[model samples]
Target: MSEQDLFADIRPYNDNEVAPAIQRLIADEEFIQAILHYRFPHMPGVIGSVAAPLLRFILKRKLAKLKSVQDVQRQVATFMNKMIETTSKEITFSGLELLDPKKSYLFLSNHRDIAMDPALVNWCLHQKGFATVRIAIGDNLLRKPCATELMKLNKSFIVKRGAKGPREMLKNFSQLSAYIKHSLDENHSVWIAQKEGRAKDGNDVTDPAILKMFYMQGKKQGTDFATYMAELNIVPVCLSYEYDPCDTDKIKELWQKKTVGHYQKSEFEDIDTIIKGIVGFKGRIHVAFSAPVTSIPAEPDDLAKLIDQQIWQNYRLFPINYLAAGIQDSSIDEVAVEQWQNRLMAVPDGAHDLLTQLYAAPVAKKQ
Candidate 1:
C-alpha cells in the first residue's frame, strides 16, 4: 500500500484487506513504469528490460491468483540475484539452514552501513528460499530520490518523521506494527533495523526504542510480549563492515553533533553516503545469527532488556572500532586501551587505515 492509503486503513487489516481494485492502483504498471523511469533516468536496461515486465506480469495476473510459496521463492531469488549484482559484495551468509524457508520471521538486525544492511538480509533470505521481508524504513530517508525508490522496490514501507506531527508519528508506528504482524501471519518475514537510522561506524548497538516498538506491536492485540515474540520468531542478525566509506562524513557530522547539539545532511547527501556504504569493501566482516527469541517474560521492561542483550551479543564490532574507542580516550583505562592497540597492530597493515576510520571518530561518542 502507498503511504496515503496506509494512513486511511488505521484500523485492523487482514490478508484480503488490501484488495486489488484499490492497492492495485497503487501498484499499477503505468505508475511503476513512471517511477522507475524517473528514478533511473540514465539507467533503464535493468529496470525496463527485466524488472518492469516481470513485476507487472506478477501483480496484474499472478499475485493472489497464485497460492504456492514456491512462486514467491522464485521471484525473491531472482530479485536477490539482481541485488547481488547491484550492490556488488563478497556476500557470505551463515546460519543458512536454521529457518524454515516458508515460515515467517521477525528479522531484527544491527544497522551498520546504510542501504546495504536491509539489502543484505533480504538478499540472504532470498537465497535461502524465503520471500522478501517487508522492511521498516524511516521517512527521513524516504524523502529523497534514490533511497525512496530503492527501499520501496526492496519491500520497505514508510515510517513518518518526528516533526511530521506527534499523532502522525504514532500513527505511522501503529501502522508499522500492524503491518509487521500481518506479514508474519501471512508466513512472510519482516526486516527492521535495531535502531532508527544507519550505523555511522562499525560498532552497532540496539536501540531501546526498537525493542519498545516490538513490544507495542502485540500489546493492544490482547497478546502478551513473550507470546508475541515467540510467535513472531525474532531472529537477530549482525552485519559487520570492515571499512566504512562514510567515515570522513560521519566524523564530520559527529564533530558537528558534538560541537553543536544538532546536525543535518544536505539534500541527497545521505543518499551519497548509502551508496558508498553499499559498494565499500568491508574486510573480514562477520554476521552472527542468534537463535530466535523463543522464551521471554511477558513484562515489557523485562522483554526489552532481553532483546537488548541478545542484540548486543550479536553486534559485530571489528578490532578497529574497539581500538579506536579504546585508544582515542585515555580515561578508559590505559591497560585495556593497549590491548585494543595490540589487536589493531595484529590486523594486517593494509587494513589499518580503514580500521582507524571505522573506529577513531575523535568525537564525543564512538561512531
Candidate 2:
C-alpha cells in the first residue's frame, strides 16, 4: 500500500486537489457570508450587499491561479503581516535558530487562541524561510464543510476528535501517531497542541494522553519509548499573547466550568473566538521554540510535566499579566498596572475578576 494511503482519511489536501478545494470554498455560501462580514464589518447594510459579490469575485480571481500550498501561504502572509503590524506593538521570537529548514520536527505548542496560535507560529516559520508545518486540527472545528476544505488547503489534518468506544479511540490515536511519523519521514514538519483544546483559563498544561499517543506506533514496532520520542524530534513551543481577544469570553467559560462543573459552547462559539483572535488586538506576542527533547522520560506523565515546565519557563509574562496578579507583586511598574486597570474600567462588573483570572493564572502558576 502507498504511504499516502495510510493517512488518506486524515491527511491534508494534496496539490492536485488545491484548485478544486479553493473553488469549493469560494462557492460555499457560508464562506462567502463570513468573508462579507469580515471585509465589510461596519457597512453591513446595502453597502455589504453590493460589495460582497464584487469582493468575492476579486478574491476568487486572485486565488484561482494559486497551484500549491506555498502559494496560499504567501497570500496568507500578507494578512498576517498587516495584523501583526497593526494589532501588536512588537512580535518577538526566541530559539528559532534551533530549527533547521532542511530538517523536520514535531512542534507541540501551548494552545491559546483557536486559530492564531498555530497561525502565528506559521508566520514566524515562513518569515524565517522554513517550510510551513502541517497543523493538527480537531474535527469538531470542521462542522462547516467549507471550513474543513479551507483548513485542508492550508495543510491541516484532522485529529478525529469525538471518537466513540475505547477501540475506536485507540485506532484513531494509532493512525494519528503513524501520520506524524510518516510526515516527518517525508520531510514535512508537524504542529500539534500539547493538549486537545485551548487552555481557556491561561494555565497551559500538557495532557499525558497526547504524549502517550506519540509513542503508540513506536511501541508497536518494538522500539524503546525514549528512543522513539527522540527520533520524532519533539519541540515545545510557548505562545504568549499580551492581550487575548477572547479573554472575557474564555474567563466566563472557565468560571462557568468551575462553578457549574460543565460548560456548553454555543454553536458558533469557536468561529466567533477564531475571528476575534485573528482581528483583535494582541498587544505584544512572543513565540519561543525550545530545543528538541532528546532525552525523554519513561513515563508519559513525566514527559507531560517536562513539556509544561519548558512552556511555562519560556512563556513571556507581559505587563497585563503582572497587573492581573495584583498591585503588590512589585514585578511590574505601577504605571503599567494603572494603565491596565484603567482599560479594565470598561469591562463589566462580573467579568472583571474572571478576566483577571484569565491573565493572572499563568503568573500564579509560574510562581
Candidate 3:
C-alpha cells in the first residue's frame, strides 16, 4: 500500500451518507437516555421518549439538502449566529480578520472547555462566510452516549485509539489523512488540536509524532506527502479563558495523574464537563486567529518542529498560570501574567486554588 493511501483514506462527509449517520446517532438509545438524564432530569421520561424520535422524524428528510457540505456549513453558521444574537452572553474575538474564506485553512487551537474550543471558533469563522471545519473527536469520547450524538452533529469524526491490529491502525490513520486533505482541497477548513491529547499543565507543546502521522496518511495515494504537507495552510488558533470553569476538575485529575501515574480516561465524565462548562459562567473568553503557516518543507523533522513552534504561540493561558508560577518561583516576575487579573475589580477567589494546584514542586522544595 502506498503511504499516501494510508493518509488519504478518510471518508469524506457525503450528503447521501449523512442521514444514515444521523439515524444511527438518533436511534442509539443510550445516547437519547443519557441526554435526557443529564440535561432534562426534571422532565418526565415520556418527554424525551416522545421528543427525540419525533424530532428525528421531522428533520431526517431535510438532511438531504445538507448533502452539499457548504449547505451544512451555512446552516450551522446561521444557527450559531442566531443563538449569539438572542443571548445576553458575548464572546469578543481578535485576529479573525486575518482569516480568508476563499482559501482552506488548518486551524489548530488549545483545548480548554471540552466543547466550546471548536464551537466558538467555528461560530466566528461562520460569521466570516467561511465553512465550518471538520473537528477531530477522540474515539474514547464515543463511549459516552450524550457526547457521541452531540459531537457528530457538530461535524466531528472520531479518531480511534489503542487498536491492536496493525491493519486497523493504518486504516484509521489513512482515513483521517484523506479526510483532512479533502477538506482543504474542497475549500473547507480543518480544525484540530496540536497534540494527541489536551495539555493538562496548560503549557502548550506539540507532539512531533502527531504532525508526522498527519502527512503520512496521504502517502499511500502517491500524493507527495510533502506536497500535502505544504498544502495544509496551517493556522494557529488560541482559545483564552479568564478562568477555567473546570479548574477544580483539572486539579483533581492532575492530582490523580501524579498519584496513579495514569489518569483514567472516559467519555461520560468529559460530557459532564462540557455541559457544565458551556452553561456555567465564564468571566471572559478570547478566541484569537493567528495567520496561517503555509511554508512546510518535506523533511519530517523540520516540518514537525516548524508546526510545533507555530502552535505554541497560540496556547491560551489562564491568569492563574502566572500567579502559580510566581508563587512557586520567587525570582521570576509576578507582575507579568497577573496583570489582567489585578486590573479586574474582584479577581476570582480560586486564584489561591490555582497556586496550590500548580506549584507542587515549589511546595515540596520548601517542605
Candidate 4:
C-alpha cells in the first residue's frame, strides 16, 4: 500500500468514505447500545429494552441520510447546542476575529476535559464561520475497533501512543507530524493538546517532547525550525470551564498516582469520563484564541515555554479559581469565600482540598 493507504486506518474519514463509515457505525452493536443508553438514561430494564430498538430505528433514519461530514456536523451541532444551554451559564469567545478564516491553523490548547476542550474550540470556530478542525485523539481511547471508526468519522486522527519500540514510536511520531503538516497545507485547521495528556493538576504547561515531534517532519524537508513552525501558523487556545465535570474523577486519579505511585484506569473509564464531560454542568465557558505565534524560537524548550506563556495569559479565570487560591493565602473576600464554602459542601471531603488545588493551580501558575 501507499503511504496514505498505510495510514488510512488511523486517519479521519474522507468525503467519499463518510457514508460507508456512518453505515459501519450504525451497524456496530456497541455503538448502537451506547446511543441507546445516552438517549434514554433514566429509562430502565423493560423500557430500555423497548427504547433501544426504537432509538436505533430513529438513528438509522437520521444517519442514513448523512452523506457528508457537514451533515454529521449538523447533527453534532444539535447536541452541542443542547450541551451549551444545559451546562453553561454563558459561552464566550475572544481573539477569533484576529484570525483569517481562509488560513489553516494548528490550535495548541490546554486539555481539561476528555472531549469538550477541542469540541468547544471547534464549536467556537464553526460559529465564527471558520472551518472546524480535525482533532488529535490518543490510541488509548481507541481500544475497540469500532471506537476508532467513531472518532475518525467525527474528524479525529489517531496519535500512536502505544507503539512498541523506539523505532516504531519515532516512525509514528514522523507520520503524525507529517499528517499535521499535510492537513495545514490542504487548508485544514487542526486541534492538538499542548501536552500528551490532560494536565491533571490544572497547570497549563507545554511538553517539550511534543514541540520536538512537530519539528521532526519539517526537518526532513530541510526547513529551519522557526520557519517551519511559523508556516504552520500555530495558535494557542485556552478553554476554561468554571466547573469541570470530571473534577472529582481527576482528583481521585491524581491522589492515587501520588499515593500508590500510579493510577490504573478501568475499562471504559475514559468513555465514561467523556459522557460525563459532555452532559454535566460547566457553569460558564470561555475560549480565548491567541494570535498565531509567527516568531518561534529555534530551541524546543524555549518554544514550549512560549506556548505555555500564551496559554497561561489567555486562560480566563472563574470565581472558583479565586476561591481556591484564597484558601491558600486568605486574601479572598469573606463573602465570596463563604459562598464558595457552601458550594464546597457538596463536594466529598476527601477531594475538597485537592479539587480546590486543581482550580487554584492555574491561578497560581498565571501569577
Order candidates by lDDT, high to low: 2, 4, 3, 1
lDDT of each: 0.62, 0.86, 0.63, 0.85
User: What is the lDDT, from 0 to 100, of the residue 191 in candidate 3?
Assistant: 84
Clash pairs of candidate 2? none
**Tens-digit lDDT track for model 3 on 226-339?**
776767887877776655566566666766666578888564686788667666555556688877766767676776566656555554444344455445334335543554
Candidate that scores best on lDDT: 2
Candidate 4 lDDT score at position 295: 78
Cα error, residue 118 of model 3, in Å, equals 1.5
Least well predicted 10-residue stretch by lDDT in candidate 1: 9-18
By summed lDDT, the worst window of 10 consecutive residues in model 2 runs over 327-336
Q: Which segments of candidate 4 are over 4 A away from where they belong?
A: 1-3, 41-49, 327-351
Question: Candidate 3 — which residues are off by over 4 angstroms?
Answer: 1-13, 19-28, 42-90, 144-150, 217-227, 265-267, 297-302, 314-322, 327-367
For model 4, residues 1-367, the per-residue Cα lDDT tens digits are 6767866867898878888877787778788778777776666778777766776688788878888888777778888998899888899999998899999999999999879998999899989899899999999999877788778878999999988899999999999998898889889899999998887778778889988898888899999899888898999998988888787788888777767899999999989998899989887899999999977898989999998888888777876788788744444457556756765665567667777888888787777
lDDT of residue 224 for candidate 2: 82
TM-score of each: 0.66, 0.92, 0.72, 0.93
